[model samples]
Target: MTTTLKISPIIGNSQARRAAAASFFGSMLEFYEFFIYATAASLVFGHIMFPEESDVGALLSLATFGVAYIARPLGALIFGHIGDTIGRRATLIISLIMMGTATVLIGFLPTYHQIGIAAPIVLVVLRILQGISAAGESAGSASLTIEQAPEGRRGLFGSSVTSGVAVGFVLASLVFLPIMALPEEDLLAWGWRIPFWLSSIILIVAYFIRRRIEEPEVFAESRRTGHTSKMPIVAVVRDWWRDLLRVTGACLFLAVQALMTVFALGYVPATTTITSSDMLWVWIIANAVSAVLMPVAGMLSDRYGRKPIFITGCISLAVSVFVFFNAVGTGSLLLVGLAGVLTMGVCYSFANGVYPAFFPEMFNVRVRYSGYAISLQLGLIVTGFTPTAAQSLVGVGVGPAWFLPATLGAALALVAAATAWTAKETAHLPLHELGTDRNLRLGKRRIS
Candidate 1:
């Protein structure tokens, strides 16, 4: 007698493609909402939000920039639990709504001059909301994409979310570049609000698309098997603490990226003669290159493995920081743009492309959201302070313009690289085996 084995429903070629496209577009919109604030915080908020602090406005502005990251891990824990317990689709939809609402509110906020201290207070509150929502977005989208991807192509497919982030930065810069280019008198008054207001349209679109996406197959399977954790945080901390530590360490690479992109923009504007328009141009050029390069890096990680690509990216960033800072300090627009393009476009893409696959691959589906979210956000929280810390290190013009921060960035990247080296290689492992102790042992055996 012949017996037929029942097969689970597979996400087909058409569906996978559709899902990836939706994920990519939705992530792009979501990040656009998130990053436009970063851009504005660096360029415009010093004047509008904290106009009183003549000596420390830039530091305060960047501090507010870091404030959002303070809320991120909490957001991650809350949203990650909901995502792992309920569904990735539901979590993502709610995050998009929260981020969009906060961004739109930022556009409408009164200036410090108009409302005194109340303006910055309200801005910080809204920024915290945006941070909370962003903490779950990449993790949720990555979880959805990886679960839907076909075997042997998870690395390639999973990277669409990161690709979306690069696209979002590009879109944010493109939107802000034009506004910054407007006459100086107009820029501070109404032009700065345009990018924040435009976030609404993308938010609405992301909400609709996310609402339509089906729950990931793996998540559904976990629920069916009664394998879902009652408390993902406890499970992750107990069973996957090592992986969480490693991922948290690996995330220092992201600190360098954010520091260069967001903090550096504000830093250069204050210390050097570079105009805000010129700085915006640098962001536009670099992110435009990154938009193309990130996917290529993602594809390459599929072929070469995640570690080599990530390591190369980190080393490149370490070296590039010196040149990037020196170029900015010299006030050469061309060199500044080149530095931005090379660091963000080339070096950062290597890390960005691989992380979506790398971070999720470190955890089991049951605790994947919690492990990835908590660790990554915790690491980011450290880097979020980097802008302020780096500024403090360069105090009162006694230190060299780029030396202190560049050294700090380099040191952080090296530590992350070392942690990554200690991490188990998951490129060849099956999705079901990921995040289990057995896989780590298996990886060690194979290496031996």
Candidate 2:
């Protein structure tokens, strides 16, 4: 019989708290920058930078948002390597600086009227940089925080990181809500740039907060013992592709948010007479509620299992997505708000809350960052192009063209559920036994 042993990790309870806090701040700050870009892309970029054909410019500007996803894998490769060989702390700090500096620079950028064709080109470049920085933020923080937590509590801590993302969505929307209320000309001319500029204050704040956080002991232990992989991604591809594929498939649930936030935010405003302020508040309030629900959902994952909660969330989200878009189409503010909260805030929270624990636990600590980052970002590339596709299909028909976002979102959530069904139950596994458990030792019985 396998006997339980009293555990000792290099991280103590205090450091665990610090890791959780750092993870939360990193996720919050990184996604805050991202949502700001998303808002600017749909609301302002088409108007200011791509002024040729406002409609086509809007589509093209939205595509630039997708362009960032392409750079994410590159960042995953680079930072995942650093996270595996160097340390999570350094990799995260560097990524935050890169993402933050790029965002601030975008704020100072000249509009197309002032800069000609150079305007959209520069914005795309900054956006790619932001994407690269973002590639590692969530994965690195998840792996780091989960590794630092005690055996039974990994889900809660990891979920804290994702909860920060909910907070980021809320904070980003809140920052843009008043700006959305401005008159058209003022919004296009100068008001659109204010939110981007305000990120500077937070970046300065995030840097200090992240600076105090130390490297996780699991990564440190691996480094000290020379157990780290020379090329983490290669190792992952060679030995762990099954888990990688599963991670990618399960990550399709992210489509719910992509469609709901990016596609809906752009689609609803254009299709019907829904006010921009109303749509913004829908997500703002939903995400604010999600920030509270996310951690609680994570705790449920700890007691139950990741797959059940995740699958339930996926199915719930599928139904919710269809209803959310239908609500938006009807021009009912109450239904739209209710639908956004139910899907984005609650259902999506259940699925998203589990992944922080679920993803990292699928791999060993050695390649955890690489496996999680590459898989997660690679999956995101599909969802990233959704807004562009939705824009292109904007008034095409009553079938696939019109209902693309909602329909595709529901379908992808089902795909995620199917994949999640195949993962081994991991809730009861000790942190050390997580990925390496099914090896030669599994068949040999030991009496302790």
Candidate 3:
């Protein structure tokens, strides 16, 4: 007797919800590891990992933070292939392991005083590895979650992953609050390492949860039907280049993020009386608001449209960043916190919430992972150095030239909004029908 093994034609809602939860916690844990490095770059690395000249050290530390972006594209190409060809689950697991291991090693690294010139070199190398890991993280998580989502709900599920990113920022800030309170000597010597070390615990738990997640039926069905691409990167570039460019331009909005978190943290404390602890509080509050609202933004995209919400976010962010910097100059923590909330929390959330679904929806499942990952990382490469560039423009120890970076951010935001306007609206398209020709949708030709 011959036996046939049957695959489920449709994924259950329960499995879909489970995939969404896994994406949420996976992003939360992975980014917790990533952003802690950002916090340390702003507050601790200059003192411990570089020469004692405060200005030069601060610039170098922020430069090291930027180094990761250079490697991110490389990671995106490598892992995007794996995700498209092998499966999203395996790609996610591999990236998490790389990220977690690098973060923990950073905690144990020797200071410049102990290791001389080798310290900063090693620091930059590790930062690059972290960047590589991050390259795969959101792309894989979002791809998995959206593939599992039922029709008309992809935005809502994808937002859960983005909202987890906001939660990661909150967790990173909360963990560092006590560390930021330590005396300068203690903070530089040891307190900062604690946050990096904490990532190990989160990594282990995340690994186990992610390991059990089944591959999304959409991807699995693609493979069974012989629709999987052998060279996804080449296919994506050739077929989806227009969408690729649009995603890259839309991703320029991340410059707003670089300025909001890394640059603002360093700027507020140095140019004003706001303590590092106060800035930490600002991070906590703003990201908390963002975490709550991101899902709402996603759901709104599911109903109204992706372009409207994202374009509005770009415009609002352009305006609110200026308000945030001015509030910092006023030396009022309350105003600064409010501005931070408006900029990072409310305005940014609108674009961020829907991007996971929006970007991937621009391509067919055969190349969706590669298409989104490559374009997203290419855009990040420019924004990643934003803090270093802002520092150069403002000059260390000069009275707040906050306006320069803020102006740069506004220009980038407006450009991203314009780019977002050019993309086709994909929220209402069926998952199987995404990335098909517009003529097919218009019934000019039959859809395959």
Best by lDDT: 3
RMSD of model 2 against the true structure: 3.9
Each candidate: what lDDT? 0.80, 0.84, 0.87
Which RMSD does model 1 reach against the true structure? 4.0
Using alpha carbons, what is the TM-score of model 1? 0.92
Model 3, 1-448: lDDT tens per residue? Answer: 1222223324456677878888888889766875788889987888888888665888888889899999999999999999999999999999989998999999999999999899999999999999898899878999998998877888999998988888888888889888888888898888999999998888888888888789888789988988788998887776778989999999999888888788888888888899878888888888899988989998999999999998999999999988998998899989999998899989999988989899889888888888899999999987889988888878445555787888889989999999999999999988888887743545643212
Q: Which stretches of candidate 3 lie over 4 Å from their true place?
A: 1-11, 53-55, 395-400, 438-448
After superposition on all CA atoms, how large is the RMSD of candidate 3?
3.9
Name the regions of candidate 2 deviating beyond 4 angstroms: 1-11, 53-55, 395-401, 438-448
lDDT (Cα, tens digit) per residue for candidate 2, span 1-448:
2232323343366788888888887888887887888888888898889776665787788899899999998999989989987889899999988988898899888999999899999999999999899998878899888888877888888898988888888888898988888989988888888888888777787788789888777678778978788888877886778889999889888867777788778778777788777888999888888888888888988999888988999999988888888887778889889988898888899999889999889988888899899999988898788777666666576764457667778899999999999998787788777777533344522211
Q: Give per-model CA RMSD.
A: 4.0, 3.9, 3.9
Residue 58's C-alpha lDDT in candidate 1?
75
- Each candidate's number of clashing pairs is 0, 1, 0
Any idea what lDDT model 3 has? 0.87
Number of the candidate with higher TM-score, 1 or 3: 3
